[model samples]
Target: MHTFSRADFERFGQLYDIEFRFPAIHGDNSTDDYIVARGEITEHSLASGFRFTFSSLEVLEAYDSVSCGHAPLLVLVVLDGIVRLTLGSVEHELTPGTAVSMQLHPDYPLQAHQPEQQHLEIMALAFDPRRAKLGHVSPSLHGLTILPRMPLRQWKVPHALQQLLRTYAGLTMTGTQKNLVLEGVALQLAGLGLGSEEQESPDVPVVPVQQRQRLELVRQHLEFTPDHDHSLKDLAQMAAMSPSGLRAKFRAMYGVPVFDYLRKCRLQLAKHYLEQGFSVEQCANKVGYTHATNFSTAFRREFGFSPRQRTVDQKK
Candidate 1:
């Protein structure tokens, strides 16, 4: 188990530009009482033109507390353990993988119940409704909107929200970059709450067996000679399918256009050579790029840094 001390919480809060406060408890308090593990208050601007906090609460016992009383809407995600939340008269049990959105009213109260030694990690995003202009968002997001006096629950986790959290917690992004990433996440969460579940299309035709076989053959061929300058028409002819048909089917199966995949393959080969200490010109030629300059441009776009810089960064 990972235990965070009070000093750890304080340092993290300072680094993230949030406030962390531990509530003072009276002597002889029971284990099952409302306690604040780390109180985070944030007002940082997001790239999407909003400001909010990424706060966590560690509940050691059963406790009731009112949160987001001043905010318009609050979003909660349970990262670990179980929590039973009572909003008004209704009760909701939130477990791992559960995302809930609740709108706050002045009189709304929340009660949290947990067993002894059981810990719950809760992340909250508090935002103002009037300033957020929730109603003005696209109609597709209407379902995600947590209206005042209403509580909403959804089953599946939003992909964008997950990505945002991953980036915020894992990546080394700073300043404008971090804000942009957070805004994107907020927008995605809003969209998921507002939009209807997208229906999968059943009418789209499946690729024929022969075409599928041909795509597999192409994949194998590329694996063998990834550095080759194979044109789309040539690949289509080899696959015995029209160029357009091959393009669409390849995208459907691989999630990237054929040419783009080829480019990635070439770049991967070049990166391997670079990591093995090959010079720019040698690596470029080995990866089918005629000029080192061209290889460098493509490499920077793909990896966000030059090959040499990557090697240097790795050394550090």
Candidate 2:
């Protein structure tokens, strides 16, 4: 078994030009071990934001369980596929559009994949709450209060949070433009996670006549670019409103959050592919899942049957 600490992770970068660093653990491995798998770990430390990471992994073998962390403090955003982890006897999962924070613990159990070449894509930020700058977030961002006692807790990562992660995860900008986008999104996440939560509201506002058109544009963009990573704040900016305003208006207009709408689009597209004789892997990639299992799981959940079953019916 190959045990990895900070230095070993860094070597994956230095030795192979991978963006990696530590506080992570991957059991035993050798250079040749990567032949059956392909992945990347990108870790960056923002001058103004917290330390964060983006990982996309595809594993063909699942004999030895791979795990990471029990970190000092961390926030996680799972974009695709199932995240597997165990704490003592309890197991936890982070699906798409969910956020979570974990504190110091001995071992928090983990794995990057399942059998059948399942892929996982995740973005995580490591932080110290006492010191992170939360910017101008509302006081009601406390959906993350699990336990100072050492366990995992779920947080409904808002649309803005999803946008922030997506914007950064799929960014192609550079220099000042890149930094501005990163800093802006990072601050949003900090505020969303660490900000003092506001009380829930039963009554919501109606969208203005002018704002309705803009929200339509946002929806259209998501529909067309179902695979593009979108940031809620940026989309709101495009819609000429505050992020909150855009969210309210969009729900009023479409009755679903931005990504939820996108998911429906992706699933529909996957169905078309399945009927047109595309393989599950091809359909998964076409629809933005890094792994086939994740795609199948999502497809089954959305359509109530496995993609394989769909394929069989298509043949029949």
Top candidate by TM-score: 1
Q: List per-candidate RMSD values in Å.
A: 18.9, 16.3
Task: Please report the candidate that would top lDDT against the real structure.
Answer: 2
lDDT of 2: 0.60
Q: Alpha-carbon error at 275 in model 1, in Å?
A: 60
Query: Which digits, one per residue and each the tens of the lDDT, describe model 2 over residues 70-127?
Result: 3334677777666655333234556777776655332334332233346666787754
Those runs of model 2 whose alpha carbons end farther than 4 Å from true positions after fitting are 1-36, 63-72, 106-116, 128-150, 167-169, 194-316
Clashes of 2: 11
TM-score of 2: 0.42
Worst 10 residues of 1 by lDDT: 141-150
- Relative to the true structure, candidate 1 reaches a TM of 0.43
The local lDDT score (0 to 100) that residue 89 gets in candidate 2 is 27
| lDDT digits (tens) for residues 48-140 of candidate 1 | 224554444444433344442444455666665676665533356777767776554444444555432344555566555345453444443
What local lDDT score does residue 212 receive in model 2, on the 0 to 100 scale?
61
